[model samples]
Target chain A: MTPQAQRDILKKHGLKVTAQRLAILDYLITHETHPTAEMIHQDLPMISLATIYNTLERLVAAEIIIVIDSLSDGKRHFDYYGQPHYHIVNTQTNAIIDAENFDVAPLLAAARQASGLNITGFHIEVYGVNPEDAR
Target chain B: MTPQAQRDILKKHGLKVTAQRLAILDYLITHETHPTAEMIHQDLPMISLATIYNTLERLVAAEIIIVIDSLSDGKRHFDYYGQPHYHIVNTQTNAIIDAENFDVAPLLAAARQASGLNITGFHIEVYGVNPEDAR
Candidate 1:
């Protein structure tokens, strides 16, 4: 997106636009693969790791990005868009692929009734070894 | 269960039964809520934190206990049983409640076809504020 558009997104999320935030946001938007904080840090060596981590926290708080926790390992992946989706994680390679959107309303409703809890959001990660890797 | 039963579980998983492992397993079996390594350490003051961590690692490798990653924070909670079920996390209180079992076969199939990935296992965690706590 344009610089002005990036600023508008930051403002919309009630976040102060900064060069560091813009860089991080731009990186996330451009990268198709779900990347961890470390992966992002590697590509942008100029930005300090602390700043990357801090920026991610603010972005998540603003609901600008979502955290995808890998089940294989405890590492987290960040997504720029807020659209609802599940994940397909490669168990051996630790590759994270977005699974198609599956309606979870029925599951959520059943959980609400059974647990008597107000459901807000859900995370689903499917783990598998890639077929090529298996072969 | 019984002392012999516990030992059998360890042997079946190719884990040599040890006092520390037994203590950890016993605690997990008795406790209903998912407990983290640190939480387990707090309960078993006699055991060193490192030993607890090591034992948890071994247990996980043995497929003895499953790790439940909390979305509110990144902390992992441990459960002894491996039964297929989902978790309902109380966002406000950080309480982890087991959601009633919902069949996810269709969802898994769709994900496999779309991603061309051989799916082995999956984790689903629903986040929400408890109605009772909200009141």
Candidate 2:
């Protein structure tokens, strides 16, 4: 998305539009790779780690982004919540790849029946190793 | 499971069988609520929080229990890994319910094809609200 679009999203979410927030949001939108605050800081060296963390917290609170802790690595990974999709985490490389082929409606239905809860949504993390890494 | 069984399992995992470890493992086996260290300490008040944390870390390291961080509560919940199953996290109550009806083999296959990863296992957390809480 364009910088203006990112700024508008921030404004819509009642977050103050700032250069740092715009950069972070733009980066997540452009790069589907789930990144931790430290990784984001490494890429956007101009932004302080504290600022990146603060911005990420605000974005998460606004529901414009989501925090994923399902990885083997203990760090919190951030993903843009613009679209609905599942994640495939590489256990060997600790990479988060987006997988959108399978439908989760049936699984959600089963969960609703099994748990007797009004299912809202779901998060599925498939753990595996790359073919070459498996050997 | 009996205390002896728990002890044997711990020994099989190369973990020293201790009274505290036995108690914690038995508690987890009896209660599938996916409790955090604080919750475990609340029930096993005789055990120090530090000890509970230490034992939990050891159990997790031994692969006797799995840690779940998918809940909205932001607490790492522990579950005995006696059997493979999925989790249904009640977003409102933050309760982790075991869901076993749905088979995830197809989903894993799709993820493997989609991401080109040699599929090993998967973790699914279906978020929802309880029936009464939903109304």
Candidate 3:
């Protein structure tokens, strides 16, 4: 999103418009891969680790981004776009890719039917060796 | 499983049978909920926190248990059976229950077809409020 749009988003969420916040969201907007705070800090050297985490927490609270904790690694990953989606991880490399437009309705139904539990959100992740690594 | 069966399974995994290990596995076998190392540690006070973590790692390495990294909370959860199953978390209570016999073959096939990535394994979790709490 444009700087203006990001600023508007912050305002809409009752957040302060700051350069640090803008930079963090902008990085996520440009990078397709879901990233951790360390990755964001690495990408933007000007941003400190503390700032990165604080901004991420604010964005997540505002529902602008979502935290993904399902990867093989124990680290927390952030998704800039909070829309519903799934992810697949490259086990060896720990690389993550978004699985867009994947449907989980059938799987959710199956679980609800089998367990007799009131199903809610589904967090799905697939792990495998990236084809690029095999080359 | 019976005591003999447990012992045989441990032997098959090349793990020596110990009272602490047996106690840990026994707790998991009886408790359907996916538990954290801290939970196990709390239940088995005789086992040190370090020992609990070590045993969990050993069992996970042996493929006897699987680590779940997806829940809202950051702590690591373990599934003892290591079978193909899903989990649902109670958002309010932070309670986790297994979604047994819930197949993910369809979801897996869909992800593979969409992403064109060689998917190895799928982790699925649902979050909702347990109805029992409403009572």
Candidate 4:
């Protein structure tokens, strides 16, 4: 989103649209892969770690973004899919693939009906060797 | 699970299922709240951290368990919701509530149809203050 758009979102959430917030959001949008707060800090040498922490919390509360736990490195890696989609993680390479196209709706619907259970949502992290590594 | 059951599961996955694994799984099942590795380690003073790490990976690969990222304290928390269910997290107290009954299927299905998007799965973490804390 443009600076103005981000600012509007911040204002809606009662958070100030600071330089740090803009940079972080901009970087996130540019980098399709979801990054942890630490990774975000790695890119911004000037931003304090505390600021990154605050920004993440604020963004999550605003419901402007969604954070998914990444099993990439067994660390607290997050993803910014911005929309609902399945994900693929190369456990060895720590690379992420936005699997927005893979269909899992049928699977979930079947499970829900079979168990007579109501599923709120599903979190799927597919960790496997890379396509090349498998060969 | 019993020690033998754990051992069988581990052996199937080429793991040892040692005393530490048994204790950790036992503690996990006994305590319904999805906990982080740190919380599991807190109860098992005799087990090494490496053991906990190894156990989690092995169990996940064996398809005997599942791990969801807990956003309770913005840490790499793991939830052992062996089966699929929605999760509710009280951010302030770090208490987890198993909200398997909340229905999100209709919402997800509608989302899938709205944009011709195939919804893979969803991770819903309801992070809020506890009842007492809110009061």
Which candidate ranks first by TM-score, i.e. highest? 1
Of candidate 1 chain B, the 10-residue stretch with the lowest lDDT total is B126-135
Model 1, B1-135: lDDT tens digits are 887788888999889889888888999888987988899999998999999989988887776887886556667788886577778888788888875568889778877887788887777888887576653
Superposed model 2: Cα runs more than 4 Å off: A11-16, A45-51, A131-135, B45-51, B130-135
- lDDT per residue for candidate 4 within A9-52, as digits (tens), equals 67877887789988887777678768888898999979998998
Which candidate order results from sorting by DockQ in descending order?
2, 1, 3, 4
Location of the lowest summed lDDT over 10 successive residues in candidate 2 chain A: A126-135
Which residue pairs in candidate 2 have backbone atoms (N, alpha carbon, C) closer than 3 angstroms, thus clashing? Answer: none
Query: lDDT (0-100) at residue B38 of candidate 1?
Result: 91
lDDT of each: 0.82, 0.86, 0.78, 0.62
Q: Give fnat for candidate 1.
A: 0.81
Write one digit per residue (lDDT tens) for candidate 4, span B3-105.
6775676677677757777777667667775667777788786788888888777666665555666564655555555566655544555566665655656
DockQ comparisons of all candidates to the true complex: 0.72, 0.83, 0.58, 0.14
Docking class of predicted structure 4: incorrect
Q: What TM-score does each model's chain B reach against the true chain B?
A: 0.85, 0.84, 0.77, 0.66
The candidate that achieves the highest DockQ relative to the unseen native structure: 2
Candidate 3: tens digits of C-alpha lDDT, residues B1-135: 798877777789999999988888888777876789999988889899998998888887777887877555778888876467777766677776776666677677777776666777767777665556652
lDDT of 1 at A57: 92
In model 4, which residue pairs have backbone atoms overlapping below 3 Å?
A122-B122
lDDT of 2 by residue, A1-135 (tens): 677888899999899988888899998898877889999999999999999999999998787888899776778899998877888888787888887899898999999999888987778888778788744
DockQ result, candidate 1: 0.72
Q: What range of 10 consecutive residues in model 2 chain B has the weakest lDDT sum?
A: B126-135
- State the DockQ, from 0 to 1, for candidate 2: 0.83
Q: Taking the tens digit of each residue's C-alpha lDDT, what string does model 3 give over A50-115? A: 999999999987778877885656778888765678777776777777766666777777766665
Give the winner by TM-score: 2 or 3: 2
